[model samples]
Target: MKILKTIAFVGLFVAGTASFAQNADEIARKVHDLPDGKTSSFTAVITLIDKSGKTRAREIASYAMEEGTTDKSVLVFKTPKDVAGVSYLSFEYPDKADGTAVDSDSWLYLPAMKKVRRVSGSNKDDDFQGTDFTYDDLGKRSLAKDSVKVLGEESVNGVACWILEYMAKDAKAKVSKRVYWIGKDNYVTYKGEFYDRKNNLQKELVCEDISQISGYWTTKKMTMTNVQTKHKTVYEIKDVVYDKDVDPKFFTVSALERELVK
Candidate 1:
């Protein structure tokens, strides 16, 4: 009877754990599906701080649109004569195809080069314009790419949160694992920790100053810190509008070059 009782208890524990993991995946999906409008545009001020505490700032105009299950975005640098006219574009797909997971298609336009170039898939881990954020970090990440488990519940800045751990499905992923503290009320990720290939903590991300814009919750300020290098980057949204009709051509490479000429 004692052995039977012990086995029953173990079975119940396993069932509970499985249920919790399912709930965590559901929560992550909700977070990923947060309702941004069909079209959105914003201006952002990005500040990059190096290990020595020296800071450089850039201004950018960003536009995004939802096309079916894919999201496309374009960022155009507006200020600083040197980097002005530089732009990046990305198109994120929702699922794997042809028996392989699909990464976003990304492109960069340099004023000096006078041409637009495609950013290769292997370079997704590279820093974006010397900032802490990588090219992959800028695009929408599909939950299907990772296996999620609920770590537990926690609080971030006094707000209740669900702690989740995500392990990459691919061995060659830049980030082997990531932990997220997602707000219970808003379904927004308030804090995240990224682990490198060796499972070493490499970076931390914090999102704050959330506000409702056009009936959608939006993060107004975000900071990414490189743990090993002590380098940091802060992005602050200045002006934002939603559901505004942005020119479809603006997302094309030809349009990127034309904008550079202006």
Candidate 2:
């Protein structure tokens, strides 16, 4: 749920000690367990760009916190009067003791309808609010759902990276395989590619403006592009603060309907 409409190598043991540390399974666990923050607040600007070069932008104020083993987050729209006051709240749970995947619970509040709509698990592959990103792309998916392998290493923009590939265990999954270029030193995800069920490249994601924010490596800008449709979505993070005091009520469905996050 901490995701914002946002691998292991198995190569032979190289000569250096650092290269031997490139175990695929270990990198998968490390990336999945990256430390973000107990509480975080940030403003996200979502921009939709069509093939004709038209662009529409939406601003969302997002807050996230950890409650016990559950992670809670809320996105409240701020600008563009047509979408102002719209909010989305989600609760992400950890995997069960048996390693079964537990889908996140999400709800969306529509101001025009004055109603709350629940985002079902079946809609994970659907586009998130017409953007290029899908609901599954915006949530914390369990690592156990995929088989990760090391594809080797490469340099992305002069940054050394480990190329990791992931194949979804679910045969019917919309995304069958994914590849990522993750930073070796900081463990930050720098680039990624998503392949559809037919194993064709569907979307590509690039993370830029990487820097340390409150001791945490943060990607301030992300762009996701659809290869087939030529539609793209850009997310820009601003005014980020970690461990900020937040209202418990902000993560509630009732609060979303009542415009508490406004």
Candidate 3:
């Protein structure tokens, strides 16, 4: 009788652990869907401050949309006098996801050049437009495209975190692997580590200033660092309001040209 009772207790413990893992996986899956597939618009003010203390600032009004499995995005800059007419469209597919981005294809629209140029495939390691996030860093993955394994739990900045290991199931992925630190209560990602083809640590991302936007938890600022060159980029969103109706035309090429700052 003692042996039977002990076996039953162990079986129940195993079942409970499995259930906890499943719940954590489901919560992690929802983190990427905050944007959904809806067309949206926002005004962003970018401020670039170099290590030398030189500063450049621009206010941009733009629209974006993500569709289906393709995940196409367009950013039209309507801001500072110089970069006003600049625009770009990025079409991303989950080339790889092991808790980090390995590679992606991006096309930039050059108004003066009047042509679109394709960027790199494994360019996630590269600085984005001389800023912080690489092209691959902007790419997002749905849970269906990858597998998530619970890597136990940890504490980050006094917050409990569930470490999740995400791996691209696609055999042709450019990235070797990725790991994410997901907040236990809110399900927001606080940090991520990316690995290169040889599985070397290539990049790190830290997200801070989480706020409630449109009744959802959102990060107001994020910093991405490239370990290879010791370069860093910081992105901050201010004066943010959500659920505003965005005109479809705002996302088009015509809008990119006409919305130049005075």
Candidate 4:
């Protein structure tokens, strides 16, 4: 939900680590701690691409901010009349100190139903809207929930990266394990892989067009592809700003109905 985390970009999520003396827990923590600015706003052109390459695009205006240890974000569809006024709001909290996970609260607004549907933690495995991103992918999962291991090094786009394999401690987790290729150069997330409980590769997230904006490293473009379904969603970001003053109303459920962000 904050992903939009990282715009999925806002934090669709980053962190620093030292070369020597790094363990799986420490590395996972650093990766989990990756910097998403205090506040951010941007317009993302989301395109759904099928294996045949036919595409459909939708415009979404997204706003996100960090308040204390909590992160809040809102996304409203702007174009494609049918989906317009379709919005989402969420509150993501930091992990508990005891290493327990704190579930995120998210709600979806539909114009036809004229009611807001609350998205529960159980739906974390569900697709986000119709995109390849699952509800869980957009929120921050606690580090304590996973047993992460460093799978050694590899290169993505020629940049050295740490291959990390994260296996959920819970045997019944919808997603069995995830592999992340995190950049060693700046610790930027270059790519990610998601698998199901059956241990089959499910989806992949690849980030590109990374740049430093307003002194923060940001990923401007990303694609989430479903390996099994062969369907993909591409996010193209524009007008991105960090640490800007965001209206408090945007974070509320009322904003979802009011359509106040535009």
* Global local distance difference test of model 2: 0.87
The Cα RMSD of model 1 versus the native structure comes to: 2.1
What TM-score would candidate 1 get against the native? 0.92
lDDT of 1 by residue, 1-262 (tens): 9999999999999999999988987998898788889999999999999999999999999999988877889998888888999999899887765435667888999989888899997788788998888887887676777899999999998989999999988899888998999999989889999999999999999999987887889999999999999999999997799998888888778888888323
On the 0 to 100 scale, the lDDT of residue 213 in model 1 is 81
What is candidate 1's CA lDDT for residue 19?
98
Q: Flag regions of model 2 displaced more than 4 Å.
A: 1-22
Q: What is the lDDT of residue 184 in candidate 1?
A: 91
- TM-score to true structure, per model: 0.92, 0.89, 0.71, 0.88
Candidate 2 structure quality by residue, lDDT tens digits, 128-164: 8778888777767777688888788999999999998
Local lDDT at 253 for model 1:
80
Q: Which candidate number has the best TM-score?
A: 1
1-262 per-residue lDDT for model 3 (tens digits): 9999999999998998798779666866666655532554556666665655576766655455554555555665565666656666565555345555434356666566666566765444465566656565655654555677777789888889988877766656656577989887777888988776677787788888986777757677787676766666667766555555555554444444554322
Better of 1 and 3 by TM-score: 1
**If both were scored by lDDT, which would come out higher, candidate 3 or candidate 4?**
4
In model 3, which regions exceed 4 Å deviation?
1-24, 35-40, 45-59, 65-73, 78-84, 90-107, 117-127, 170-174, 253-262
Candidate-wise lDDT, in order: 0.88, 0.87, 0.65, 0.85
